[model samples]
Target: MIRSTFVRTALCALLAPTLSCNMLDVNDNEDVSGRGARVFDPYQSSDSGAIRLSLQQFNGCAILPSGSAVSKGTLNLPGYPDTCPDLLAADPTSARSAPTGTLRLMAGTRYFLNQLTLSDIVLNKHTNGADLTDAVRWMKNESRFRNLDWSDLGRVSDQWTFSTGIEGFSQDAWTREVLFDNARWRTVKDDTFTVEIIDQDGVTPRMTPVVYSRTDFLADSAYGGHTRVGWRMETVQAPQSPGDVVPHPLPVLSGQPASPPAYRTLVKIEMVGSTNPFKTFEAPFIPGPAILKVTWSQLPDEPFFFPIELVTPEGLAPTCANADGQPVACGFGVDPKFKFSTPANGQGYYEPGESFRLFLDMRDGDGNQMLPAGVLPSGKDMLADKANGLLYATQASYFTLLERDSLPAYMVAGPLQKLQVRSDPQAKAPYWSANAESVGLVDSLATLSAFPGVYGSTWTTRYSVNLPQDAEPGTYVALVKTQRYFLGERVAKTNSYFFQVGQQEPTTYPNAVGNCQLCHRGVLSLDNLRHGLGVDHVEACKTCHQRDSDLVPRIQTLIHQLHNSSPRYTQNKTDCTVCHLTKESALRPSMNVCQSCHPSVHGDEYFATQFSAKGEPNRFGNCAQTCHAQSTTNGHILPEN
Candidate 1:
């Protein structure tokens, strides 16, 4: 196979210099880039991740297809069904009532008690030849790898920042609170995620979890805001850990010729300063979750210095500049000082036929205040040199408000109704800047609006809006988007001001058993839902999801693809009852949503291929006429076990 791969590559290089070969990797059956691509030689790529049967291997024929045939197993998930039958029978009709009543809300952090995690993984690899030894399978927490304890290692934020330059965090431990999003706090106690390493030799080895913890793995401080920790790896020499901290047992990613999965986040950190930690290695670069993968032979080796890099969620890629062309400060946003003054977000309200006051005070890193429409700067100007072009310019800037269906805490926010834009500069109040000509919104709402100004060194603005009698009696969020020019680049920032209308009917978001913790082992990333939103309950998700989306699949289809590929589902598929609350009783009598996840039950080759290719299942729940076939076959009225 290796020789064959090379023959094709060699011929391509000689015959067409411009054409490169994408040789096939026999192990994973994936394409390996050649020459200009990753892997230059085919043999070198194949031998890197070669999964040969160990002469002392115990498990035989442990790969997909052969292993996938095993009966559907069950994980002891809390509040979820243990067996398929129990799940189908758990009725949620009584609890699935539409929110009838409501209550009032104030602005603040709505602490959500979310919990979830990855279930135990089931190893099912195929075995063709002999030489089977006790093969080891470890799902190392790629997110966490520690050396000495946290106290000894200190906090991640204590010394690390973007200014550390590239390779700043080469091989070090990151504090938990600073690294992991608040959503992931519950997943790790003392910044650790442990998965039992399974050695499935004979009859399924006892459940073993490979622990990923911080050097100072202990109870979170009662004072709050504790740090999560993990170590970085260098390839120069082996890794060395202090007496208290140690490395994880996960395998290392070798220089395989194949391109890793898109899910595998990799960054090539050019080593800076000294490679040896014992010498002087100030962990440069952004600190993130490391991918720890070691070879089968290197299990017992100490001072583990295998090359390491961080794994970031989709949008958190560490780049100097991002897709939007904006320069990246660290892995997130660029230079912009963020602060909110009066009428802070998640507060303020408007009732029908009633007027509400909207006051705003914001400032930029340059300490220039926000002026209303057409205001000029008074002090330090960062961008344009002209009167309006350089200073606090508001002629092109505006603030828009959306009539939301509900508050941001419980439902998909609006693209619903937009308030009228005030066209006049009749604003109330003073403003500040280097050039203070005149200021006000391009369009402003009625009543005591603030005129643009650059005086008193303040970015103050105000508005009074009177709601019509026919306005929807719901919630509204006013987003004040201000724009400025910094060094010839456009810089923008938005401030959210949430308010409710008359007779506010307050209700709690409905996220019972399907709490994220039940699935993610207690980590939920609410980045980029509805404009980077996160909701706690089902009712909130239904507002935008349960329906059609211009950019994403409907809730049903999205759920299928998300869970179907999740690590938890790979172990057991019957745990659907965990993240869902749709009662069987609530479902249409003639509808069976089971096909959403169990499309394989269709039995027909065409039906199987068609839907799987769609990357989702029958979300509308008309399996009866899917292909001139009934929802179920034979006498199986309910979903099969």
Candidate 2:
């Protein structure tokens, strides 16, 4: 197969010079770029940003190849020893040389990086053969580069600048690039640099270079603020165009070629400097959970350097403290499962005009309160705490209450009722900044309520909401979504709880006939449901997708139509058991539900003729009790599994 691929590629190459070998990559397949044209936004181009490089070289100075030197004495560049030995110490002659390489820069830093922006920006455009790795696949199809596209390709703040004030870096200084619209990139860690060595042929591996800064090793203390480092790659041979044909001997049969093509990508560091000088002495560290201390030096032969300063202050590390200025035990950020506890509370019974309170807590994986009940990181202490690391610094929080119904309905009817943010009485001011012009403080907590503790991770929050005068008497789902900055990355947590109004033990719709989690897990979780409301279950879907949902179809009708057309539903879509766990419970005869699968049943001719004997104008009445009661299960087939 390898030989066949090589032979085919070689054959295509041979015929390329004289003829248009467009079939080499077979363009007859679906045009991926064209298919995605309607949604393509020119401004959404990921590589639209650029970075500039200015190499700093002091001639006659005994600088190490790593771009570091101590008053000039000896110069070493490995394999090229004595390259600049016995250099003058006071040599002031300096020249900046623009080396030949490709400078690559990505937008945003780790702390502020946004995945949605990264998802849109694709770094590599090549998509032929092995290069077609990033192409989207159907259900259960795993690609080797599954996560390659989701890397921290931060949105470039401008055409040139990118910030480095990430998790481990200081927030004092940032490049000129303004972080508008919540755009972000990956945080810069100590070993974030991608360094590679190549042979003369450009296809062979060489030795890795030691990367460091002029003042000290590439540590957290050296990388905060506006510190920036640009990367460049120099290949031995220029990149070959897809249409270019390379002359090579024909390959032997049985997947063996005379010479297999290889590539050597040598990373060359051309420039390393700061966009601006450091301004503050405070750097954010995660206390004992994520402390960073640099204790390394650069080698004389290493060929890259950035200037970093060690900020010194008494007790620079921020400790978790209570509002009374006493110390407390705490960690860095919220856990993936931040909504630790939300009891049913048996508060299902409520009067139409009466109000009810729902309580919940947002905790970390270690069962620690999101924010200390009595302890608060605010004012100068908050700043000092953030200089160490932030905890529960919410960027935004949304609470949506939806009333349940036997059938889906529009918002005005009875589906969506309320949307609130700060509902807890103890919640003081808004912790997030909704203004595009303002930057949110990294130390603000989501809920500062000092509510009494119940669970080990108790940070209980109370949500008070009143029922409408004509409110329905069924279950209500309250979705609480909180977005915050944790260890420099913007993370979100969503929790949904069910309660009743004007009823004893709220009733469920039983619309969730199937175990949808079988397919909708992990990356394909229900968070993608209905504009990302974090509705993790199919049952929660009925709240918004009502029978009178205005522009959208009902949940039952929508699910049937969606799965029928979905390419991922390889199983017999019409099979009742695929979605319906039990036929007797879910397979009720209803013209409204059946027409979603068989639209022909909605016509006047079918309804009139089919129900002529029954003497009915339309089949809107009791569908099962009339003619189709027993026949409802006739056409449906059961799955062997």
Candidate 3:
């Protein structure tokens, strides 16, 4: 929401090259090697260079049914004061032993509620902003947690806790982990069922159980703070006749009442039913209580910490409905096909300051056509207005032009030059016009004719971009990402398009500085990089990571420091070649890069003084001129391999 009074088109002048806008008579870009400019085509589906499309999805907490009981209060124990308190008592230093609490089961159920658990919790936030120590501590603690001994710690069948689950798989993918052995438990039978809450130390016991009502638990700041906090009924046993009231006691101490005096709840118990694929363990409890029918969708709409899935489209058509609401076949696959269609007679080549138009054939990841195409019920060609342009259907609302502020195209000059959307400021045109598109349709009558009124086709949703008059001449890359609805799920994909502008040969960026595979190993594919683009090489990351005058050093510094702080990165801290592919690339260090590793050697003031020589600080700011020289390599111990 950074609103700017400056016109959007006027902003283009700030980024485009100084060279005059002019068309190239021919494609002189030798780097292209005579390759056709057709990067993606849904109809052909045979272009090896087509940007890979993957489904975008995130896994969310499986919501419980409406009447289920969950903890609702926060417990502030001693030691850690205001950082982030817990809903349950988590004071590890407390010396209390086997503190008892009562549990009551209402009548009409066969078994009484036997197991109680404090589940779905995250305690600490490990951040690497101003202090690197927090991140380092997080890594170490995570390692210890992953390797903890279950036998020695003792298991509490009903209890579960969550973690950020760094460096490995998590039940909810970076969201939750089952902290089964973390809790200590004791079982006792009083007038009503009761259990003892134990401290994590395996020695000190809690004074009294801290159980919050479902409402209070959800209201705590930490309840929705990081992940979620709530207790679970892990197991149940013993038959109780109708109307039998078994009491569970949770008393108020200094601050607030642990929970209400009494509240009826519907609990989902372990039973013979479809299993949750994400759960790590099988049924820890025997069959008890009635099972509730629940449903979930693979479609990921809700945002999680980091939510995006990368996978090649299977081209599998999903079941869809026609405009008439009748069942129909959605053509095939959700990966939208794209290709340049503007600047006619240019042989797929573009020039500076040219009208650029690209065609995107929209499809739901499931084969449903997103935009209306084919023949209408009136027997008129759906694309009859191709001479002009067709308006998008209401469903087009699902399509989003990501990175609206900054146009997706980048000029691969000395550094990455962000291309702006062409605008007319003098005419008072909005600066955002560069990202604006006059939506149109491409003829798909050849194939879509058969699916008349079925609400689908191999039609293209067109976008027209007017390149700035002073647009730089070089290879231009457009990383297009669009999201659409697929069946009941939200799906998206990102693809890269390479086209020449202003005739310098279309050479790829010199991004071979780092040997990413040395550490990433077999997982260094495009999907693993997870930046959305399908290009296998790391340079594809530059699409967004390109040096921005405003946000350059922050990312570089964080990345460098994060790697140096990782417990898993065992290489010598100064070993540049471990990641750098060539000695020259490693030797060409900038002040920002050096400072990331040697924070204690100098202060920000000194770095800024050196950058003053280059006018304004940017990605190219270097220390070699003012301080570090060739001898800077002498400080590092290079591997002999």
Candidate 4:
């Protein structure tokens, strides 16, 4: 009985040690104190607690539930020698296929512990057979690995192997299109291990599948160099599950019909402001990411490419708040949303009816600044003058903004006094001629005479006329000449109206024809030259003539000399009869004689006469002779004479 007790005691001693060893191993593997399982605490610090929990949660449960096996799995990955020599250098060149390896995984595990000892793992030379440098430099400068947080992983030793705890997870096979390559994959297995390969070019080493446990569950995870690498835990059925059921529905067919595309709403803005005659408001345009539609009137015909930018109120002068209560820039092309800096010495904004004076800083599409004169300048005031003074005869001349397929519409603004005229004249009585000669009138007198039908009361007229009691009873002609102002000078001339007058006999003379002082109230005389004479006497031969009967001949000669001497009045020295007739005869009423008195009025040469120098006496020549004839002259000269 004592011997049996001894044998039992010895057996108990042997079993006691074995039992203690078992308990220690179980404590190391099981999740205790609510700490996560499968988390290898190499540093064993409070800071690692969160990382431990995350890893365990991601893997579903700890790999070794209390009292499990301690043997860990071995992972061997195949390396492509030709394409990736750094990983597959040990393999023979003839073996184009990857070098196969094995991973010894303990059965029924959620996570695995692997000691990647530096001495056990070997880094192959790169394609150029260059040795790998510092891993930190590779992670930072290499494109592929630049985004990876290297501090999160273990450090690289002289042997370049990293010791880590990997969570075992499964993924369904997925196909991905390789960038810049046509090689497609039908299916791949989920990989259990990962390693970074450094290239000789110092590029970030790409992490490729080294070992995949389930080929059917693997996915093609190739991505561009910039793609981020991360992992997520998924609860997938074990490969050895009992049921034969499809896990997820096949991905919905690609290229399915989609809804029609939608378009963005566009807002249109119109800027209105006063303009000056001397400056142009280059209408400002505001640009944004959205498509812009600009609408304006009084703009140039061509599209004005301008530099557009957002601006604050302080940066833009003459700015005012728009309807939306936002400050808008003023001046030519001032867009409310945009700020503009004009050229140096710019006159800035201009008010309507004010002299325009702003100059724009021109630019090209590339935003290169240009000089004002190189494009358009304020000094060239043509555009401003046109905008302020001229009316567009056609709708097209007005400014407009139109869509690609739309018809152009006109703007509503225009210059003042669109159409202007200078004067109106009354017709002569008793066989009156539309020609100016018959009326014995010159210049425009309709304005001064206050003639009812001659000068309309709406605008000012330069002159008006009155007739004398001794004026001829025959028909006389009247004339009105006008000059248009442009750039401080007359640029155009026009004649407006012509009408007839009847004889009132001796009973009365029209008040308009009776008052010469109405138009000629201001007068100044210098020697024989009388300027500022009444409109009636402006060009009248009698204006300088006296009533002495003996002086009639002398007055005629004096009148001829005065016209001949004035350069502004005549082109050359010529005889009085060259433009006038001394007789009342029809054939003697020289058309040339009338032309001589109003030479410049006809502009250039006058038409030739049909009558000869000795033609039969006509009423025109007969009247001329009655006034100024040779005392010894015989009867009228015949054409045959």
- Report the CA-based lDDT of candidate 3 relative to the real structure: 0.29
RMSD of each: 29.5, 26.5, 21.6, 51.7
The global Cα lDDT (0 to 1) of model 1 is 0.23
For candidate 1, write residues 168-192 as lDDT tens digits: 2122111111121222332333443
Least accurate stretch of 10 residues (summed lDDT) in model 1? 51-60
**1 versus 2: better lDDT goes to:** 2
Provide the TM-score for each candidate, comma-separated: 0.27, 0.30, 0.38, 0.15
Worst 10 residues of 3 by lDDT: 395-404
Candidate 2 — worst ten consecutive residues by lDDT sum?
397-406
lDDT of 3 by residue, 1-641 (tens): 01123233223222333211211112222122211121222211122111121111101111111101111113222221222221112221121232211111111111111111121222233222223343333322432122212223321221111111112211111011111222111111111112222332322432232221222111111111111111221112111222222322333444532432211111111111111111111111111221111111111221111111111223223234445645454432244445565444433346666776665544444444444443211212212222111122221011010011111122222112232211111122211123311211322122123435533433334556677777665555554554322211222345554555666344344433434433432212222222223323344443333222211113344356557744345678777665544444454455555555664345434533322212445324545554566566457855343
Q: After superposition, how far is residue 441 of candidate 3 from its true place, in Å?
A: 18
User: What is residue 495's positional error in candidate 3, in angstroms?
Assistant: 1.7
Best by TM-score: 3
Between candidates 1 and 4, the lDDT winner = 1
lDDT of 3 at 516: 43
Model 3 regions more than 4 Å off: 1-337, 362-462, 468-474, 482-493, 503-506, 519-524, 547-555, 568-573, 582-584, 587-591, 598-620, 637-641
Residue range 445-553, candidate 4, lDDT tens digits: 2222223343222221112233333333321222221111111111111111111122211111111111222211211011001211122222222211211111121
